[model samples]
Target chain A: MARWQPHASERLVAAALDLFEERGYENTTVIDIAERAGLTKSTFFRHFPDKREVLFGGDTLAGRLADGIADAPAAAGPLEAVAHALEALGRETFTAERREFSARRGAVIAANPELREREALKGLGLTAAMAEALERRGVPDPASRVAAQLGALVMTLAYERWSDPAGHDDFGEAVRQALAEVKAAG
Target chain B: MARWQPHASERLVAAALDLFEERGYENTTVIDIAERAGLTKSTFFRHFPDKREVLFGGDTLAGRLADGIADAPAAAGPLEAVAHALEALGRETFTAERREFSARRGAVIAANPELREREALKGLGLTAAMAEALERRGVPDPASRVAAQLGALVMTLAYERWSDPAGHDDFGEAVRQALAEVKAAG
Candidate 1:
């Protein structure tokens, strides 16, 4: 047996999600996930603090979003800056290959209260990251907050559309459509 | 040792908040909270599922906001209906007398990560409630979601101001001011 496995983290996440779907999140355990991944319990612990954390991916997404917002064109408005960030996310994180996995992950999260709470907290963290990044760009108080809130909504709506099995649009295009819908509603 | 006590739920909540502030949320147990409230542990359990829920007040606020939205005048727009609901909340839930308690509760929740996660989840629930109510009023899909998202932001902004020790505006006034700020930012 190998002392170290490449893509260990990804394997554990896939194993956890599979077990969570097959036997429900409440019924799945760390040992079960580790067994499914053909890894020891210690190895699973090395990747994620717990089963819940396996799906969350830590603060990586938040950091990428903040950096994306910070790196937007200087002339862009707040929402345009957010749009730019979402476009970057499409090119980097939310690529077409990940759509099926995201759809599965979304379903697992929606079915469990514990995962839903974690997801909600993660959503707030992303919004805060965007808000702070906007403030660093010299956008003022409530406007920055308002734009961040709308931007988070845009991401959420876009992710939903992009992850749906029947949908064909890329993440960036979905974000554009969702942003237009939000603006029109406002 | 009277088995039946008046306002047992309120007393338990206040005691839990006090203990949470003094000893921190993780250090405070249900028994300690019940003892502080001069109630039996079973009575505390009867009132709340756990110590964390003592401050949440269950779904009463969601129910009230939904009812308030539903009761708005037929001529009201989606955001106007949300405003009407918030005004009713000022009169009914976030009354002047509860401001001090709310401030303390907010501080305690802000200090603890578990409490913060729960608060974030509760905020999402409130947003979902508002969105469903708007949908019932024949508001369309993304528009209903957008108005509810903005409405939740208005509630959050207004609650912060209303709970500030130095702020004198009532909840309704703060809601109006927040709505205006959001509109201007939008």
Candidate 2:
């Protein structure tokens, strides 16, 4: 049996995170990350636009979340819609094997205020995407609005729990639990 | 009866919004806003740390919102506490007299992705403040988390309705409607 070699994008992301943690996000450069990953700088750029993107490069997750909600059954309510979106994306994006890198990436972002702010912006974008998807399904104004924002919030809260080393967490279950908590409180 | 001049800060905010809207946020300089406001650059600097702050430099609103939640009567539920926060700030932050300026400020923020990002970060900060206040009042982990996030979400939804020029929105009423909508969905 042979061990698996990480994908190029994953290799770059991991290398970037380790560099950011050790030398700081600002001090680390693209070339350094590429060298550390045993790949060329061109290979790095082919995946991420910049050193920072190595951490949060794509609209990949955000797009999936939006598409998930839109692709859900027409009859799903706002909360149910959001839960479905999370579940749909969980199979690939939040798999157990990715947990350690995700946590590391999160820690790197947390340590840098600029990255934290960028993360918040990405969070806002996802919420807006959810709102648009739900509105298209004919969920009413404020309900769609509240659900979208809550959906983003659930991601934040759930991701934290899911990535915690002490916990064996499921992304879809965390999302469902978070939505239930809000529904119960509301 | 004698009419009073608007406060220096108000003039600066108004001037900055006018400039940012007309010339774009990046194109407008601090001196340009100061001149438009009929104030000196020194006076503008005394009020706001930077030109961008003109639209977002108010700790007054955030403080009142947090204080309201923290000061809510001990027996109040989470939703009640949020309603109290909005009502408490409504007297000043969302007053009819300030509506025009606030709306203008919102438009300026919405037009610029960077400002929008900063606003999202501020929104996260407010949510954190709400959660801390709720926990102090003895709300538990997931409950407090959901409530705090909902508190922020309600603000985002209500503020949009409140700022629309066509609507005669009341802050407390908007909050109640938003919370009711969520509870109904839940």
Candidate 3:
């Protein structure tokens, strides 16, 4: 097999996760990750601001999701719109390799309390941004919030399933099943 | 007003919150909280394991909710059972004064990333526990996870409402409204 050049961002994340697992998150530095990625500090900084950003890496998914929701048909209800947005965004954001990487990243973050909290704050921020996007589309109060939150909740549950060792389905299927279960319970 | 003696735990929490507000969470020592509560260090230690516990001492809400779900009538569906459990638990756990205190506590936690992550972990743990309880009740595979997560999502949305300055309704009402909106959206 040939050595393929990975995307700069992907290479940075792969390097960070490897270093974090080997030396622990607190012990690993940005320079260590940059070197491991075979990139200079400047290239690493271009992709990510700091060590934590390797895990967070900005809100690209949230922006894409917001755009999807905004472009959804006006006839669609808030929940449907948000759900469609989540589904589309999941396809773009979470590839098979990305799924494995994210699961590993989640485990590392979960092991540390402060890192876990930061992850939670990130989740909340994304949810808020999604809600704002829904509101901008004329989705009214409370419904906008609930739709955004529910969309995120389903996405999370689906991701957890997709990441599980026993989980073999695509993220879109997991999300559909989760939503169906919710509808059934309701 | 007549001075009423509070239980050691209650007194300790009161002192901790007061000192946290006055001197900041990092600046206030355990000893300072103990002295303000008119208790010995041992007494404070007996009630709380650490400074963070004082802020998050009421996790029993999850256990209470699980118990309620376990005891719910067999005729009720999983969602209904969880909703009833939440309504009962909300009334018991969130009194008017407690609501105000909780809102303030949330604000304080939001200001600190570490505290916010701890709060998120606690919430996630509670949701997982609830999912397990639902499984025990024969709620089945995806339904169990979906119901538990949706319940938590409703609680989260309700919390956002309850913590808002304009939010004057009880927690139960807020939850009910959130659920209704979700159902409507679906």
Question: Highest DockQ: which candidate?
Answer: 1
Candidate 2, residue A5: the lDDT equals: 38
On residues A97-132, what C-alpha lDDT tens digit does candidate 2 reach at each position?
888877888888899987887787777788888888
Sort by lDDT, best first: 1, 2, 3
lDDT of 1 by residue, A25-139 (tens): 9999999999999898999888888888999988998888889989999999988888889889999999999999999999999999878878888899999999999999999
- Per-residue lDDT tens digits for candidate 3, residues B70-176, read 98889988777788887886778876668878877887788676677678878878787888889999988667776776787778878888877688458889889
Q: How well is each residue in B8-69 modelled by candidate 2, as lDDT tens digits?
A: 88788878888898999999999999899887888888888987767777666667777899
- Which runs of model 1 end up more than 4 angstroms from their true locations? A1-3
What lDDT score is found at residue B154 in candidate 2? 73
Clashing pairs in 2: none
Q: Estimate each model's TM-score.
A: 0.95, 0.88, 0.79
- Residue A69's lDDT within candidate 2 is 90
Cα displacement (angstroms), candidate 3, residue A88, comes to: 2.8
Instruction: Write model 1 residue lDDT over B1-186, tens digit each, in one string.
Output: 677889999899988988888889999999999999988999988888987899898999899989999999999999989999999999998999999999999999999988887898889999999999999999998888888988999999999999999885599999999999999988
RMSD values for the candidates in order, in angstroms, are 1.7, 4.6, 5.2
Q: Candidate 1 — what's its lDDT?
A: 0.91
True contacts kept of each: 0.83, 0.60, 0.40
